[model samples]
Target chain A: MWDGRLLRVDAREQAMINEEHRPEIGESFPVHAYYSDNQKVRIHSRIHYHSYYELVLVCHGNCDLMVHYELNAMVAGDMAVLPDKSIHSSFCPPGEDTQVLVVQFMPDFVYNGTLDTVDSRYMAAFFNSLRMKRHALFQTGEDLAMLQDLIWKLLREYQEKRMGYTVYLRAYIGMIIAYLIRRLFRNEEELINYLRDYHRIEEAVSFIEKNHREAITLAMAANQANLTYNYFSTIFHKITGHTFTEYLNLIRVREFERIMLGGGNSVSEAATAAGFDNISNFNRVYRNLRKSSPTQVIQGLRVAKS
Target chain B: MWDGRLLRVDAREQAMINEEHRPEIGESFPVHAYYSDNQKVRIHSRIHYHSYYELVLVCHGNCDLMVHYELNAMVAGDMAVLPDKSIHSSFCPPGEDTQVLVVQFMPDFVYNGTLDTVDSRYMAAFFNSLRMKRHALFQTGEDLAMLQDLIWKLLREYQEKRMGYTVYLRAYIGMIIAYLIRRLFRNEEELINYLRDYHRIEEAVSFIEKNHREAITLAMAANQANLTYNYFSTIFHKITGHTFTEYLNLIRVREFERIMLGGGNSVSEAATAAGFDNISNFNRVYRNLRKSSPTQVIQGLRVAKS
Candidate 1:
């Protein structure tokens, strides 16, 4: 949480809250919160990319944020929205005492497994950042204050993990995204065009979700979206941070997990029912995607049930 | 829309746009849009109440909005959120040339037949207004600007009626409500308390929805909410603007309509299935709530289908 208590923390504790918790594969809710004051300790300056969207708010002092190799100076009340797989890094001056709050959430956190156009619009700013080659930044006065307040509430809810915290987290995230989109896209025509294109991609995703049980291909999904295979593949990877095949496999793995947890099915049966052809191939894909074996997941589910 | 074109319209054309379109009892989408300029014509000053929420945004000049007998002087860029059945009227000085935009929508537009606490929180401001005895008025600078932009887009979308217009309308309405809640309840504890109270009412509503087919009473709902019967009755009426019996009857009428439209059910059968035991009482309540006969609705549905 971005509260006043953080101002008194010692130098040794500066990085304590900055330890990132990367979302695990198939995690139900994949939102992580972090706070850092770089004047007390060295900030992470390495250029890297992740498979989730990151929203950073500069609470105090100044810093430089690099998105897609473009450096932009940011002062207090500035916000940076970095899209998935967009290479980004940050730098803080030695004596500026720069403080920031960072929130990382997977695309699923916004989409929630649905292809609603409004949900796609929530992600418009992030994806638009890629095309514009400039990250979505909000520097307005009152709107920035409201956004900061929402982020603080989000961080507090995340840290406390109270009953129904995830519900509040999602609500706050939706509000933040809505605010960012309205502030970032001042041109109505640009917003409409972006939403139309996103709707097309969502159509393709909806196709995959419905047909994951069958032998589906990128060409089929592209046809559903009325886009060429290559074009669809490029934008799909850019927007989703996954190749078509990888995404399909991930969906199948998720379905397999769902079926296994639903009970009354053996591991192989669930795997085959999820469109995997053979046992060995399913095992390989499952391990590569989930970072865990099928047996281990089943054991974890059983333990949780007990 | 709140564009400049409205400024050029003649006095006779003023009420042309302000003509209210109240939502029919079973209307699929229950949202209406209106634009008014008192300079062009006489404003609707007669005190009135309706069965929907009304949101008013002042675009130019100033006006006085009276809610529940409390008069508030609103300037340009001010907004008023009036809860359902709240007696309200407006007064514009003779030469002030007050221009405003109004949006009216039923609770179903926001709740959409769900018991989600987040959805209830969106209506927190409106419900809280009754207790606070003053309507929700947003006076901040940038936030109000963003809200005006959204209302303009909403009015445009409503007038154009393009493809997926309802989707955009709902999205914009959600954003507006979110902004109002955040701005109105700056105190975090107040927000939490309001949400808790709203959630309790929503739980009672959810119970009614699930058991509407059974003979349920106010005491039953109060028990479900863990509130005293008298307290539950008072708060439920105040928050929902309907007595417990009236709300239950409305729910049943809605269900009966749903069943009749689903095809292959007689009006009597639907009414009985919706928890009305006698045909005469069913007809009376249906007529009182929906303002139309059951056979007329079935005929309309049939004609539309054909």
Candidate 2:
């Protein structure tokens, strides 16, 4: 997946660059910026990884961003930080008229010495944002505008070569990371907390999705994550902002609602099918979580359809 | 002077750049900037010219700035705007630790369209400031600090490559020019007024300097610049902010004071040497301009010597 002629570099030079630093960036100037307007961006040959952080911002139109095994639809103003060694490609259909601005630079460009310093939060956040992005879609319109503005500023600084330009460029990159930290990961403490449980949380979420049709317990969920019961309960609240039982019930209720909306199943029938064997327990959990009883939700969906 | 390899480009490339656009700039990027800290910048091989305007601002230490036939000693915070085709070089003494920020770009980078419009005044004022600098040292400490701040901002914006960096750069360049115009040329109407007669005033001032020891008259000064009496008078007032006779007297009084300060001569003889043949007229002009009679100036010098 990493090997391809579409990325464009002399073979020996590419090898030297790979050994020395990264592709699309060199030791002379450890930053590379490009503004591309492509109607159709091919992905098969373009799937590759790099040693630098790649900021790909869609200026206009829609594209599908492929990161590892994930394919997510991305539209105008959507962006993603493809971290070092993350295989990613952006594909678009013909006549999509997608415009994307890509800026890739070495991590050390934003890192001023040690990451322990207070001034290094932006650099820390840069790494954290890339790692913590469960949803790569940058949701807020204003936040997207601000990020695009930062990219534009970076491009001008890179191209103009103004006085103290390197300083300006690095500083702006730092600001971009700070902006992402605010918009993406929330805050430093939360980001650190998220990073700690990222893998564990993913395991828990996937396990619940696959086993929703069968009986599931907190101990079973903890065993799936290879964690002890008490440890799993404590960490689940810290990571997902919900306890194992509550999260599991919320998932079951959501599935039950979807089944009821799909057609003629009674609330109790759908609730049992979604692994909620106790009808009274399901009704109580659904009313508490959804602020409405299962019957009311089904009636509301029917009213909308009618 | 134009024949030198120090300029660092092949002849064909130079011509093509001079024709195609400007170096350190392309059609895509119209502005370029650089911050330099060089202690010993040699001038012997550094004399060159370009198609774009270059603004060199000294951040620290001192250097000898050569712009055309004028050689001025520039100290820290001093700056010079080298307009297109201006023969210029900066020579520094070794180990002085001089730092400077340079911003260079095609003129059209500032020119948004019609030169005659008010929107283009900043560009015009920018070019005019380069020409109207009778004191290119930038003078006031406050003004120097302001310009330095602007340079720093430009350097930061240039390096950061933020979104709308081009817009920010172009706007900042316009602002730098605006600041200079206000501080250097005083006001807009006055700036426009100065620019109109800038060349003619320069010619008149030089004519008076060379012919000050002779009998100088308003008509002679006007004819030297190939202008009529009334027209020259009007232009002289607009350009120098002084009437032609008042300016000529001001110059004569200055030269007369210089001669008297040298000593060993009577006030009358010194005044005659400065081309004030009528001693009574010299006394009146000196009293009006210096607020002291020639005899009193000589007496003050003698008292200081004693």
Candidate 3:
């Protein structure tokens, strides 16, 4: 996968910020860990988005990385957070071995449990690309030192499968995320600056999530956004890439499937549980997106539970 | 964790069978994988039972294992299956580094997915201690060779983690399990002979599982076992180590909690959904087992989603 295009980066290209790039780590837990020296040739040159988050720590030699579309120098001991679904890539710097360690995991790794409860208002850093643009590299002396300690701790936890290592792994990763939030961003306001409508969108999205089980209309969402119906409809699509009704239906379908897997029986019951008063419409939307029937989905769940 | 008690095993111990010993992997999935050399000492010598399943493959050196309850020799290329909730232990035999690979995961890792759809009777090797006795180790020439190939493939998939490694890992493990069930068992009758009361006990258990939502009595259970009420009660307790009513309540509480987490709202609703006709009794049992109210669980799930 390597294109063998390592190059030097001056001041200008290093400052450019890439947008709409998201990367994925594939696995959700026990972060994907890799170490390489000469094998660094496989750090592909393709600039792409991953569906999960990634953490790259320089263990030996030096390198340059284009994270979120910005160039940054990574000497030995440098580290950076490639936020979930963010665009990033790595390259070997001229005349360097660039031995490094990579640890990546899916958003479900931290986005599922206690860390998610504090709300996005508190988790502004993880959702912000601006912060990722400015402080992409852990270059500050204390930040680098602290990060190295955490990285070694993670490597130790991964290397040694002691009792409750999963718990430790998550806790250590939580520490890393918490550290990034507290240390990387100057304050909460700056962290949320990437998206001017971030809070409004978050609140509107939260409202839709809370009421997806109820009879919701476009006007209701527009009012929740404190915008005129037309503007709200337009901006919601612009921000989320989905129409208001479409997004609501998506939420409902996801919840419907969750209910089915969680042991709710029957298509009608799951539909109602997922906030659908009309069975035919729910089935239509479900089939449209899933390309499968509700019965088939429930049967799959039954098979899973068998 | 090493007890410094390595020795040669006589032919007598090499032929013994261990019973009722369950080994736990703690984390369910995508599974806990570990590589060890001298680090094998960390596996401990407790000779204890675990709540989850485990797989141990000897990569280097020779050793003897206490699987279930019996001592057996494990050399290079030998692999042992530590069935869930079965008693087992390991010790490094004299000479060599005793390098090995360990893959451990919780019951839910396999029990919840498509693997369960085949019916536990056909997948009986996983649940049956009787079969555990007949074929704990893949020592036969063909079985050992096939297992080594699977183990190496697993190790490679785990180590390199090329694209879609998680999908590949699950598939490899499934293949391994399928191979065990197919290759290890001599024949259908041979497989059935390993378990004397497998069918009867399975039928009685299935009945309780199906009827745990109703007001099930000891007499009902005895009738399912085709034994007199008193005799059935005695054997049920003897086989399962729990009285019929106690086991029934356990099932009810577990199902009740499952329903609550599955999106059933309100304590009363979850209780009813779990098959509890009487509120006070269900509440008492739930509190004793969970040490928290159903409301707390719902709130926790909410936090998990947030």
Q: Could you give candidate 2's per-residue lDDT for residues A1-306 as a string of tens digits? A: 222111211122222122333453754566877677775553222445567777778788767776643666878877877766565565776666888887887766555345243333344544644643422456547677877777887798678754334544555665566556556555556656655665676788679878977888888889999988898888878666568787788667667756765674777788898889888888788767656556666675455334
lDDT of 3 by residue, A58-130 (tens): 8767777765324677788777777654545667845456677777665555443332222233344454442
True contacts kept of 3: 0.00
- Give the number of the best model, judged by DockQ: 1
lDDT of 2 at A220: 87
Candidate 3 Cα outliers beyond 4 Å, as residue runs: A1-30, A38-44, A93-97, A112-116, A129-135, A143-146, A156-166, A186-306, B1-219, B222-306
Task: Show the colliding residue pairs in model 1.
Answer: none
What is the number of backbone collisions in each predicted candidate, taken in the order shown? 0, 24, 24
The TM-score values for the models, in the order shown, are 0.44, 0.35, 0.33
Q: What is the lDDT of residue B26 in candidate 3?
A: 40
What is each predicted model's overall lDDT from 0 to 1? Answer: 0.67, 0.63, 0.59
DockQ ranking from best candidate downward: 1, 2, 3
- For every model in order, the fraction of real contacts preserved is 0.00, 0.00, 0.00
Worst 10 residues of 3 chain A by lDDT: A1-10
- Which 10 consecutive residues of model 2 chain B have the lowest summed lDDT? B1-10
